[model samples]
Target: MRVGLTGGIASGKSTVSAILRDLGAVVVDADLIAREVVERGTPGLAAVVEAFGDQVLTPEGDLDRAALGAVVFADPDARRRLESIVHPLVHQRGAELEAAAPAGALVVHDIPLLAEGDRAGSFDEVVVVDVPTEVQVERMVRDRGWTREEAEARIAAQAGREERLAIATRVLDNTGTPEELRRAVEELHAELAARP
Candidate 1:
C-alpha cells in the first residue's frame, strides 16, 4: 500500500512516521527530500537563487531557510513561486523513491503538504495525524522554541485542519499521550499490513 502521511506542524506526524518506519514501512520523507533538493550546487538551489535572489542564500552558499521562510510565509505569491520551483522536483524524486521500494512493501510518503498540494488522491491511503490548532501552536512553542506568532504563521501557511481532515482516509488523533499515539500507530500498521 502506498500511504500518504500528513499533519500540521508539531502535530506528531513525524513521531507517527518514525513508528511506522520501525514497523518495517518503506518511508519516503518529503521534508528530507526538500532539504536535499535545495542544498548548495543542486539545480534546485540554482533555481531558488534565480527566483528569490542571493538574499535567500547563506554566507556559506547554502539555502538560508529562515530568510526564505520569512519571505514566503508572509507573501502568498512568493510562497506559490517557491512551490512552483520545488514541488515538481519533490514529486519527481518522491516517485523515484517509491518506485524503488520492494514489491508489496507498505510505502509511506511522509509529505507535510499532501493536502495543501492536493495530492492525497495519489496515495492508496491518506493518514492524517489530527490535532487541534491550539495544541499544535502550544507544541511548537514548547518543543521547537518558536514564538506563538511564528507557530501561528507557519500553521496559517498550510491547509487548514478541517481541510486536512476532509482528505483523510484514516485519522490518527494525536491529542493524547505518546504511549497512546504509539498504540494507535501499531494498530494502524497491523491493519494496513493485513490488507492483501
Candidate 2:
C-alpha cells in the first residue's frame, strides 16, 4: 500500500513518521529527498542558482537554505518557482523508492505538502496527522522557537486544516499525549499491514 502522510507544521507528522518507521513501514521522506536533490554541484542546485542567483548559495558552494527561504517565503511567485524546480525531482525520487519496496510492503510517502500540491489523489490512502490550529501554534512557539507571527505565517502558507482533513482517508489526531499518539500509529500500522 502506498500511503501519503501529511500535516501542518508542528502537527506531529515527524513523530508519526518515526513511529511508522519503527513499525516497519518503508518511509519515503520528501523533505530529505528535496534536500538531496539540491545538494552542491547537482543540476537541481544549478537550477536554483540560476533562478535565484548566486546570492542564494553559500561561500562554500552549497545552497544556503536560509537565504533561499527568505526570498521564497515572502514572495508567492518565488516560492512557486522554487517548488517548480524541487517538486518534480522529489516526486521522481519518491517513485523510485516506492518501486523498491518489497511485495505487499507498506510504503508511506511522508509528503509535507501533499495537500498543498493537490497530490493526495496519487496515494492509495492518505493519513493526515491532525492537531487543532491552536495546538499547532502553541507547539510551534514552544518547541520550534518560532515567534507567534512567524508560526502563524508558516501555518497560513500551508493548506488549511479543513482542506487537508477533507482529503484524508485516515486522520491521526495529535492533540493527545505521546503515548496516545504511539498507540494510534501502532493501530494504524496493523490495519495497513492487513491490506491486500
Candidate 3:
C-alpha cells in the first residue's frame, strides 16, 4: 500500500513515521530528499541562489534558510517562485524512492504539506498526526524554543486543523504520552498490513 502521512509543523508526524518505519514499512521522506537534491552544488541550490541572490546565503557560503524563508513567507509571488524551484525536484526524488521499495513492502510517503487538497489523493490511504492547537503551540515553544508568535506563524502557513483531519483515513491523536502514540501507531500498522 502507498500511504501518505501528513501533519502541521511540530505535530509529531516524524515520530509516527519512525514508528511505522520500525514496523518495516518503507518510508520515503520528502523533507530528507528535498535536502539531498538541494545540497550545495546541485542544480536545485544553484537555482535558488540565482533567484534569491547572495543575501540568502551565510558568510560561510551555505544557503541561509532563515533568509530565504523571510522572503518567501513575506511575499506570495516569491513563495510561489521558491516552491516552483523546489517542489518538482523533491517530488521526483520522492517518487524514485517509493518506486524502489521492495515489491511487497508497504511504502509510506511522509509529506508535511499533504493536506493542501490535491496532494492527498495520490496515495491509497492518508494518515494525519493531530493535536490541539494550544498543545501544538506549547510543544513548539518547549521543544523548539520558538516564541508563541513564531510558533503561530509557522502553523498559519499550513492547512488548519479542519483541513488536516478532514482528509485523514486514520488520525493519530498525539496529545498524550509517547506510549499512547506508540499504541496508536502499532494498531495502525497491523490494520494497514492486513488490507489488500
TM-score for each prediction? 0.98, 0.98, 0.95
> Over all chains combined, what TM-score does candidate 1 have?
0.98
- List per-prediction Cα lDDT, in the order shown: 0.95, 0.94, 0.89
Clash counts per candidate, in order, are 0, 0, 0
Q: After superposition, how far is residue 192 of candidate 2 from its true place, in Å?
A: 0.7
Sort by TM-score, best first: what order?
1, 2, 3
The worst-scoring run of ten residues by lDDT in candidate 2 lies at: 150-159
Across 1-196, the per-residue lDDT of candidate 3 in tens digits comes to 9999998888899999999999999999988987887777789989999999989888877778899888887777888788789889988998888888988788899999888647788888999999989998999999999899989887887789999998998899998899999999999999898887
Across 35-107, the per-residue lDDT of candidate 1 in tens digits comes to 9999999999999999999999999999999999999999999999999999999999999999999999999
lDDT at position 91, candidate 3: 89
What is the overall TM-score of model 2 with all chains considered together? 0.98
- Candidate 3: minimum summed lDDT over ten consecutive residues — where? 113-122
Residue pairs in collision within model 2:
none
Residue ranges of candidate 2 with Cα displaced over 4 Å? none
